[model samples]
Target: MLRIKKLDIFVLKSFLLLFCGTFFICLFIFMMQFLWRYVDELVGKGLDMNVLAQFFFYSGLTLIPISLPLAILLAALMTFGNFGERYELLSMKAAGIPLLRIMASVVIFSIFLGGMSFFFQNVIGPKAQKQLWTLLVSMKQKSPEVDIPEGVFYSDIEGYNIYVKKKDKDTGMLKDVLIYNFSDGFENAHIVWAEEGKLELTADKQHLYLHLYNGEQFENLKSQSVISQNVPYRRETFKEKHTLIKFDSEFNMVDGSFLDRRSDIKNMREISVAIDSLIAYGDSVGRAMHAETMQLTYKPAQLSSSDSIKLQKEHITVVNVDSVYNSMTSAEKLKTVTATKNRLSSLASDWNMKSYITQNTDSDIRSHQSDWHKKITLSLACVIFFFIGAPLGAIIRKGGLGMPVVISIIIFLIYYIVDSGATRIAKSGGMNIILGTWMSTIVLAPLGAFFTYKSNKDSAVFNADMYIMFFRKLFGIRISRHMFKKEVIIHNPTYKEDWEVLEDICNSCEQYARTHRLLGLPNYIQIFTNNKHDDVIKDINQKMENTIEDLSNTKDHIILNYMNNYPFLSTTAHKSLFDNRWLNLLVGIVIPAGLLVYLHIWRYRIRLDKDLKTIIKTSRDIQEQIKNQHLY
Candidate 1:
């Protein structure tokens, strides 16, 4: 937990970066619709910058709730990804920290952030939405000049297309009116043509009046009386001939828990408490059963009518036989009857036990019970995903937008699709919500654990060295230990042969090469064998030692070259290279300042070589001793 606290700064930074990135991306996409809807209405009205800014700020807050969770998930992926990519995670592991412990901080951060998001969704979001819509309505109605267009037909403002054929320069009166009303459904929908019309403003300027001198309204009235009358009106009044344009569209309010409207904060708290209790109980039960199932069965001793009748029939048959055997000796008859009764009782008991076993194995009860059980399983998905992303970052040991982005997308997509489908099924009341949401996690949790375990145990499952080996197998390429140059053997006498030592050396060299690559060092060195028959154990060890030394020299030389060349470049080019070199240098410094901080690392390695030499000498000496003993 202290370690988790220590990582707060890093976790917070990652969360903020991810949150901002997602928010901006969402803003850019949604802003166009937002601006398009209001831009025309605010053009000539002299809209305040403060109002627009406030609108956007409130809108942004509403958007943050949905965006934050996605951002957190992506951020976690990228953070661990960077750690893995940079080998910082590997370094942590090498220092004796487990991957799960390292992820403790991220999990804590996500939970806290998730809680914040839930709050935002419930409280700030509703207020922001209400304010945004109210402001848009206020801005639209106050200014008529805002909705009027000079040339184009403004149909988008309302359902009718208002066209001005001619206009007065002084009064701004639109003449030769043509109004196309498309709102009243087809056929009844009609176009109004007027010989002369003028635009006038009401006393409040809140309403615009269209005054007509002479106009004929075209309509297909189905009533015979309306068709026969043929009425034509040419009248104009102050308020009678005005269209009250209501630009305000009703907006829905987001009010309550994410899952349910009736769900209050208190209800959520209760639900959380209940969930915790249920999870604890279910987990204990599941462990006891050694399964995730939650069903149990027992049989009552009460017999059904059919069973009673069958027993009665068997008894009556025995009684009838006894009645028929009245003349038989009493002792002999009693003994026969007792033996028969014991056999019948034993058979009935066996059948009852079998029926009880069958009744207890019912899956309907299990499925119904598992519905709630599924929720507990699903609740742990977020934690399991952390398990996957964290250690994977450590294993892949490369984190940047490139790999992290790709991996995050794949993982999140899989999670989202499964979660969504399951939720939909659960909501329709067909399946359990918990099971639906958690099915993806349950399937993937073990897979992630397997990868983490393999990584911790230093398994070569995802190790890049395997690729080289795979390629060699596919291409049938072989490199012999003898073909590679052999170093001079240093002599000593205490060394002894341990065949198992070969596997240990191979694993070490593989790990060393991986660490070197992560540190941005040159060529990885590891043994590649096409044959297991011949032992090249000593040869592989010698080559690995030489390669590691070479890797160090190669990195030092590259650093030296960059440092020397940086002083002699042109201004613009120099700036570009300088920026890149500085980043690289900062990254490179980790290898020496961090990995090589212990002088004993070098000393211990040197001791390994001396021990190997001693083992060789001791083996030769032992062989000589054995030969002399045989001669004696």
Candidate 2:
């Protein structure tokens, strides 16, 4: 028996709640998208409520695989984001709990979801897809409800148009009706006009009967061959007339067997079997086509007994095509040329038609194979997205739908675009079906791993300040003043002693600025190759910090303010640009900046000169303030 820990339960409860909400939302969104795609087929069909319900039900089921991965991604992001936002994750880490341990419950749940998604894809998805498409086809084929409005010609019926000047709703009667029937052919169309008429459906609801009180029918008897001749037609006037029109009013379900052979309607096993059969059939057809082409292009000459005997007698004669043509009479030449032309044309047409059929078959095989791989790829996406989302959420330290929603959408869009492109390429046989189908997964799996690793170490992956400093260093941008916290001193004045130390520091800075080549190309290379200036910068920083600490003991606020103006030099200012050796190497290799490197070095040299000047001036200012004030 396994016992669930409190932490696991807490994490699981949070994640499961978000997952359920997001899953249904995603499912509804995708279903709406699917519905919009087939809106034309669904609308105005007067479909039964039960039929619509079944369609939406099946559509929702079919879209489960598509929505599952996105839901897991969003839920995991929100869950971990909430933890990070509220400092719960920090507390956990402080209490000796690792990120991986905290994520154990959610990861298990995501794995279970992935398995469920796979089961749905393999079992429910295919059946739902089949039923949904079948219903759509049936709806498209179903006749529109007879809704003829007055004063407009209604052509909803197969081969007829009806117009009514006025209609009586209560009695279902039409006055001044006109009808055009072209079922025989447009050229032999018949037109009828009635003073009054009534329409009714047949007992079986498969036909319509229209009874006219007084009407005249005109029939056209025009022939295609007699286009220039006078047309003949007949007209008949009747007091009472009845016409029967074939119209199926009942909602009949299409046979599922009609779409049973489609790839979308098959399970993984069926798809695999069908793919194998198709590939085998394609191979056999290719061999047959190759044989036929070879037979046509490389025909062997017949050898009779007489020709064989003649070949053994004296000299062998080689026949040339030009000579053979020249030997024929004019009439024979014409006949031969015409026959050859006809034969070539027939062969070309047959080859084109057969090639087209073979291509269609091959495309079908690729589509089936792609779908088979798609089921697995979509299931795997859930796990991949979970890793990506959870780690990213923890790294960004953002909760709710604000930042996480934006990031999730961006990531999901990238995945969607890549997946769509790969699927298109695979469908067109531009790449291997398996490789193309799994391309998005292949691309994103490493990203998820990288994020997880970075988040586990509590790395500031999205720290704007760090990246800004890096860019500033790269571009050789330096500001005169640095942002620092201000402090007030309340002890008795030690300005005299501190002022002396400040002057000595100023003197050293001035001497160092003149003698040291601290910011040129040579210094840059030396810093990375060997830390030649490390001790000097470290010593200076230590002295600055020590002096600031001693100054904090002074009582004069004026002296303390002046002393605070002297900025402490950073040790990293003269060190290598990046702390990571690998990153430095990568930058050096990728950006072989000859001129840019020199420019950056020149800029840093100027900045260092300015910083030294500023430090010297600040120290002198403090000394001047201490001299003007009377010592207590």
Give the number of the best model, judged by lDDT. Answer: 2
lDDT of 2 by residue, 76-108 (tens): 899999999999999999999999989998898
Give stretches of model 1 more than 4 Å off.
1-69, 84-87, 114-161, 165-175, 180-206, 211-224, 227-382, 458-632
List, residue by residue over 441-499, the lDDT tens digit for candidate 1.
76778977886787667566667789998896444344532122224424321212222
Q: Which TM-score value belongs to model 2?
A: 0.86
Each model's RMSD to truth, in Å? Answer: 22.5, 4.1
Clashes of 1: 11
Task: Provide TM-scores for the models.
Answer: 0.44, 0.86
lDDT, candidates in the order shown: 0.52, 0.83
lDDT value for model 2 = 0.83
